[model samples]
Target: MLSSFFTISLKPVTRPIFLYLLLLAVCTGGTTGELKAADNKALAADRKKVDSLNQLAFDQKRFDVAQALNNLFNAENLAIAGNYQKGLATTLFYEAGIYHQNGYDKKALATYYKSKLIFESLKDTLNMAIVNKEIATSLYASGQSGEAIQLYDESLTVFTKLKDQRQIANINNSLGLVQLDQRKYDIAEASFNKALALSIEIRHQYGEKKAYYNLGLLEEKRNNFARSEEYYLKSLAIDRLMNDKFGAALNHLQLASIHQQQGRSDASITDAKEAYSSAYVVSAYNLMKNASARVIDVYRQKNDILRASEWQDSLVNVLNMQIANEKEYALNFIEVIKNQNAKNTNAEKDLEKQKQVQKEQLLIITVGTFILIIVAVLAVLALVNYQRQRFFGKELKQKNEIIEKNSASLDQLNKEISHQNLLLEEDNKTKNKLLSIISHDLRTPLVNTKGVLNLVNQGMVPPEEADRLLQLLETQYLGTTSLLDNLLFWIKGQMDGKEDDKVKVGLHQLIKVLEEEHRMPLMKKKITLRNLVDRDLAIVTEKEMMRIVCRNLISNAVKFTNENGTIDITSRLGDDHCLYLAVKDNGIGMTKEAIEKVNAKQYYNTTGTSYEKGSGFGLMLCRDLISKAGGELIVESEPGKGSTFTIRMPLS
Candidate 1:
């Protein structure tokens, strides 16, 4: 008993098979969607962990940096296992940053380039451009400013192509700083101005801070301390408001240098101390290094020996701590490798023992199996000979059957050859007939039109006579167009067999249109044409094909019909649900011999009762169109009477 609108579908399967399938689905992700959803969540978690670790390492926090490195290695391993290439590259990049921080510049640069290459292969333009910028900065620090400038130009080109305003501004700002170091003041100013303009246009707050800082450095290089101070303070305000510790630290360091140069010892000392504090907050090592030296200089100028000595000792402590960190990092890496090698040695020993035991057991089993195989081989050989004899007899019978099949095939080949020969003969005749018409029916009209146009162009004819010639040309043109249409249809049908677009078509309406189409021709012959088709007599056939057949029949009738002759059309749907349409003309009829030749498809150009010339393609075309419609043409006529062409097709 089931509710009308509710039904439970039943599947016929055993409970054990169903449970196995369910287990298989869970393992193979055939269950609806949750597998990918879970994978995406895990990937997101992995990415987030990697980003966090990278941030900690960037801040240079000692305790957190070690943990961050461990987490980053784990993330890289996970990314590799998941086949996440981009994530793997990203983790590698951060790992390289950690190496750079530990003062392993060679390893850091190598890893950075490898990650950059990966981004390039992936065609990730944004990440590739960023990695290029970082590589350029490292090169500049290594005193390869020329190579660094080249890489910077490459990155700038990529950023400009991307139209990323913030990245472009950042690249421009960095390029200006490098140019400033190289003492190219004009180029540096131009780069800084471009950065500032772009940053303002896009409202990039951090990029604006970078641009302002670079501009300040440029002015300070030109000995314009007043202008430099204004730019530095403007950048410092933006950095503080945005809480960018690195930006704020750099601004403080630049201000300290400016003050020291201006002979303001007390103010320079205050700025240097503040810059050192900011370095600690943002892991700004270079700023802290410069600030330390600045503090010593300011104290020495004031004759403060104790404060200068203290600042010098602080700088030495920073260098010593870095040396100690690098030593520890190297020792830890060596220990991990030793432990892994020891584990591999133990596993190898266990595997060798297992192999030795398996070898002895395999030897014993092989001897027993070998003895059994020999006896089995003899028995199989005896059986195989018996089967071979039987197979030979069967093969002989199959050979005879195949021979008989070949003989039948050869008979069919002979018949097909004869049919093809007949088709070739008929095709040659058609080509000849087509050439005759193309030369006379086609070219004659064009030549007449050309000659008449020439006469008109030369004003060789009287103006009144020119109008009559034009009328004659128009009639000839219409006739040529009609002939071309028919010829095209004939060629297409020959190349690609006719296809059907079937629909119900009323015979009365179709005949009425055809009668209107040839109304002038009928009037010339003084023929009274009547359409006796019932309005309801519709046929299910291709309309265009059927219409063409009927038009050809009526045209032929009008060609043969004498003056004052009558033509009529009639149609019916029989009880068998098939349509029959008849076109009759009371005119000079075809002789039985002539009709037989036409039925045999041997009709060619011939004159009608009025000696009207034609290609005789109409009757042949009627046969072809009717045959394609899956219908047949039936004819009834005598020499003294008239001809009736009837089309029999299916009714809708």
Candidate 2:
């Protein structure tokens, strides 16, 4: 029977539970290469059984979702108990597909993500691509076409890289559907045509059928009914050849609509009855209901009340059966909800534990620093007493002798006190810099990312806005990563005694990275960013430190620059065997006082021309890093003019 089924596998199972069954049957029919190494026959047998159950459930999914869901839950539990990751992911993916088909879009997205994460962790790129494609489909249906297309492109890229022609064809077909809905007729046709070509080349009848069907829809939208009818007929031929009753039902219903629109009552009725019979045999109640309604409408139009009445009774029965099936599905899907809730609870607990550990570590460090400061102050007081005693008189010679006897101890304490003072100052600066960066730059982007993600998850972001937000999200993500890198480098330099790892650093490449990181800001202000540094310009310095300093300078430029302003980054050889790298912005310049503070290595707060906030500690951090790297920072600015922040680093 299985061999016979395989022989007729000309039709591709697309967007239906039947596809899952076909995949599961093929996968479980033999020892999967993924698990063939398992020496335990019993374990393999168990996995096979689990796969079989999934296949059986999928076979019943559309007609009896309740029973199918129950089977899926059992499969999920067994996979969990056996630690069968691939099986578990497969079950979750199928379950999500069911939820999507049932109109539970949000639930489906969540489940799809869970499956995707598992596939990612497993390094199963193919499965991850598959899940992403499904998620995009759901997004498209939910009217989030922009986000959907983004996801579709991401999936396509992966599929393309893997050279998976089948998935590639499928993605093209899906993209065509989205473009069709958007009424981009030419683009849609191109997409469908590409999918068709790929499918025909691969002999993927299922993909071919879908491409034809979508092409039909596109023509129908263009009011080219004759062309549409031809496409539907081709698709219908495939459905019949594949013995896909559900597909036949769909084709017949479309044909009925076209015939009715053409004012051919008899033809419409014939097509409608064929659709109803096809759907009835497969227990596809929804299609049956639609087809029956069409037949009833045609008969009533012809004043055949008896015929309409007969069809009306059939419609009522279909509706009742559909409702019953829905209720059953709802009852079983609750188990899935409970499982998801439990997982969420566990995740929340883990997050809370992590937060608690971070808080405790911070508290410990803060308390220890406070006690060290107190000890340092006490030592300073004793040193002052010793100085006064030495200056006072010979009357305190007895005390003088004791002090002299403890002179080595006092000297050691003095050295420690000096060291502590330096450390305390550096620690204080680090604390201020970290606090400012976290409160201002880091926090905003993270919050924005979270807000955008939440909006996406809730399906509330509009297509145009979502596109903009996606760009913002990417910019914010990269900026956040760069900022964190800077922080880590600075922190490491402060804590570690290792010298700067000097290397040949390309100034042009460095500036280019900063340009990309600040692209959003530059674009927002319509600023022209010119990287005038020579492509081969190189400097021997700590790459990360140089990166941090340069990032701050470019960021400040973008901040201060007004709309339609220009910012130029230029590098030249200095007279002192050093490189002069200047970031010059022609917009709102800094005041003389601000320039003085910057040149003097002092921290001061200032806002951008657009009221963009800054940490005020960036320049200070840059100055410290540059000074350690045998470099100097110079600031030149005046009110209503442009500003230039230049770094002079030794050429060696």
Candidate 3:
């Protein structure tokens, strides 16, 4: 009989012949006497083969999963060939167990159902109950806890009737976890206590450890920190005795979390480190990740940045290991699925190929007929398209001639329209400028004159103060007259569409004239105005335009100058052969935006430091005059520092 078993030569033979002989003897001893007929002997031998393979698979699964699965699949094939229904169901159950252990819950659930159906057909109640428990466990893992609880109850009832204390205790633990998840705390506690009492009664150390760990979780959830620690310590002691590093790691992590909840950070860190070490020893990547993260978090909460950074690196390494493990597990699962279904897949592919061959033959004949029809249609279309192209060609030539003639007329019209638009834009600008000046600047002098006359006529002014006020009024009136002259020149130049008259003007004389023009405001503000230009510094520019630019710049300086501030008008001939006339003032200066607006010749309004009023059109008009004179106006300013307004003009 042992020779017969060896002659079959089952693959993936990790164990010796003696091991198979031992399993065969244990499995077939009762059936050896019942083998009377030849068919009966063959059936018994097939059943023995399946049982031996299943036993071998179970033994191999601990260290070599692929080899284990291969053994189980071989067993499955043997059982199906022999019509050994019980053995086939058992093989499927083992396969599903493997899937569940490897974290393939959906596959596990599917395989479990297949096993359950077989067991039901055979009326194997105990095996069916076992399958139902596995299915429930898989469902719980997949987050279908409601369905899982119902199935668990059915399985628990069956096991209780069979007096299987081990299964009863396991089911109670599983039920407690579901209840705990649903937050039915008291119900969960009762279930966990039952599991604990039964596990202890049976002297099942592993079951007791699991029960203690679960109770620790329950107490932790209820915020009973001391009690949770007690249960976790009990679990830890059992884990140590069993030399289960994985279980020890989980218990330490739970203890660490409980310590953290109670604000015992130091104790929490110690426990977390212990957990990390234990998990590392077992190569438990997820547990190591959790332990490291807990340590990093506690260090961060303590405001220990250095310690946090150090542990964060460790956490990253652990996370990488976890990810790698997950990837490897996924790849192995795919391989397992392919290996399990390879025979069925091959049969289906063969059938599909035959169907595809018939489809292709019919398609080839249809496409050949369709291609002839398409060629006939294309020939007719080509003739029609060629005739249409000839007709359209003559029509396109006529349209092209007409378009050319129209395009010339359009071009002339566009040019005239553009020129008229430019003239209109210039006229609009001149109108806006004149209005701004009249309404804001010119009105001020007239209003001041009226107020002075009214006060004098009423005899409200004292004689001594009246003379000074009248002098101030006379100076204002003269300044207004000068502004009017400049405005008139500007308007005339715009109307004539010509540049202003330019001539060589002494820079020194120009500044001296401006000094006299702004004398009253200068005296009123007590600002010292200096004329630093060399008398020989002269350039050919429109004298009136230069005067207008210089006058406005000086007036602005006087208006903004604080009491006792200074104004300096200087000229220097640059190496670029340009006259740089600058009116620098130690007065309240412009912001960068204000200076940009001035340089860009944009019209804007702002009151001076002395609250002096203006049209805000001075800078625009001065820039226009300077540009027309073939020069550039440059402004530099800093808030509270001062400003320099420079006119750059070519000597030629």
Candidate 4:
């Protein structure tokens, strides 16, 4: 029967309406059987999420577009999980409506087109027409009237062929509104007349009421006051019977305006009062405000100042109430969201508990089965071993004792050889690294010291500038001494290792010596060094090794520190009863790759912040000595953020 009908030309649905109507008509298209039983858990969760999001969006009354989009996303995911193509198309259509309502015309049209294609493939003509109508309405909202008209004609043709009278009436009324707005009075009048006739034929209450209200608008715009009044009364009566407060409010407000125009102040005031009450019942705040203002105007037009003042006060009260209501509404929305989140959280917690319970049950069953199998196997093994032991236990003990002694001797000899080989390899590496350091770091300091001494001995240095040159010479001498100290100790360990001499060393005393040792060089560079280590905190470690470690850490901090930059030496006692000493500098730091290499104990060489050269052995030697004392070295740095090198040592 749908196919027997012919195509009919009609204008498109008006702007900003497809979204409202699409929301009214859409429902899920796929059956529950589309998903397998095993997939029910996931599908059920996705379905719940979709329903929750959709409800939030609807409850928000199009104010929350994000939630609407989120709902559409989950719906699509559910469709994919069930492999339901029709479900996906329906979901897309709903999502497009949301976008269209939110003024995302391009996105709305694209989404609707995707849904339309899918529906067409499924041979769903009704949905295809529906999607086309949405796209056409969105196009109209986007101001593409020519294309909108074309698509509307096509969609109308489809709906007409399907003999969907209700839909036909809707399209006619919407198109009539568009024609009226365009000021094509004759065309708009004809459209509304057709819609009214069709709506009455099908007894579609909403359509009939809408058509009457629109016809009233058309006749009023044409200055037909009596005719407009008749149309409006018919619409108003229908709205009251249907218990549509918003619709009734609109009709009453319109009737009030018509009465005001006809000079019936008393009747106009009555209708305006009724309209404000109805609008208030529906929480139509804008309508209430408008109706209250209209009532005040009707009294003012009657030249009754006192009555007009009373109505004006009422208008002010209505506005004040609307403001208060808006605030309450916002709070209610927040409460709703909070409640939803709490429910979801509780649901997830219950799911986790159920999963945990199932896991425990499975574990118990598995362990019990394993214990039974183990007991049976052990019983047989024990019986066999007891018989074999009775026959051979005495002979086996004497022979085993002899074989063990020889094996122990051979194992001890192998251990000694492996230990010696490790020492040799370590010694060779130490020698190569020391040579590399001495060639640069040691050589330059020694040469500077020598040159200073020659100048002093020959009296070439002036008396007035002698103190300053002596300070420079002293700095050079101290650096050379520190370098030689590290080389001698490292070499001695490899050649003839001895037990570390542990002593209670005060960090304050130790750091004081270090400060004095590096003071000349620091002064020359104008660098400030602060020692924040506690005076009473004493740590037990090899005295000489600890000194070398502290000296090296401080030296590196100062080396990398730019002129006038500050370095801080601080220490803290740790939970492990260890002392943590930090040498921090406010200067250039390390890049990620450089930090990785340093942490990995790879050979990392870089110039200092002031282009000061380094042997790079300072850090490596510090690491080795700290490890020998059962401590750790931690380096923290980033480019332009400065560095902190921390030494962790056992307490005394």
Q: What's each prediction's TM-score?
A: 0.44, 0.45, 0.47, 0.54
What are the Cα lDDT values of the candidates?
0.79, 0.85, 0.85, 0.79
The alpha-carbon deviation from the true structure for residue 11 of candidate 3, after best TM-score superposition, in angstroms, is 72
- Give one digit per residue, the lDDT tens place, for model 3 in 1-652: 8555544443224245446556756665545555446668898999999999999999887656777888898898778767799999999999988988887778788889999999999998888988898888888888999899999999999999999998889999999999999999999999989999999999888889999999999999888889999999999999999999999999999999988888899999999999999999878888999999999889988999999999999898888888987788677767876876895466457657867997997697567656644554455456658978888998999999999999999999999999999989977986887887888689989998999988988889999878988987887786688678777766766665666566888889988988987778788788999899998878887787788888988888887889999999898889999989999998888898988787777776787777876667677888888887778988888989999999898899
Q: What is candidate 1's lDDT per residue for 338-442, written digit by digit as tens?
A: 553565476557657767877976686566556444544344446658888888989999999999999999999999999999999989989998898888888
Runs with alpha carbons beyond 4 Å of true place in candidate 3: 1-226, 230-250, 253-273, 279-392, 404-408, 411-419, 432-462, 492-513, 528-544, 562-602, 629-652
Off-target runs (Cα >4 Å) in candidate 4 are 1-121, 131-154, 160-165, 172-205, 208-238, 250-275, 282-438, 446-470, 483-499, 526-528, 560-566, 584-611, 620-630, 634-644
**Clash number by candidate, in order:** 0, 1, 0, 1
| Residue 257 error, candidate 2, Å | 1.1
Backbone clash tally for model 2?
A: 1
Using lDDT, rank the candidates from best to worst: 3, 2, 4, 1
In model 3, what are the clashing residue pairs, if there are any?
none
Model 2 misplacement above 4 A: 1-56, 332-652
Clash pairs for candidate 2? 12-206
Query: TM-score: which candidate is best?
Result: 4
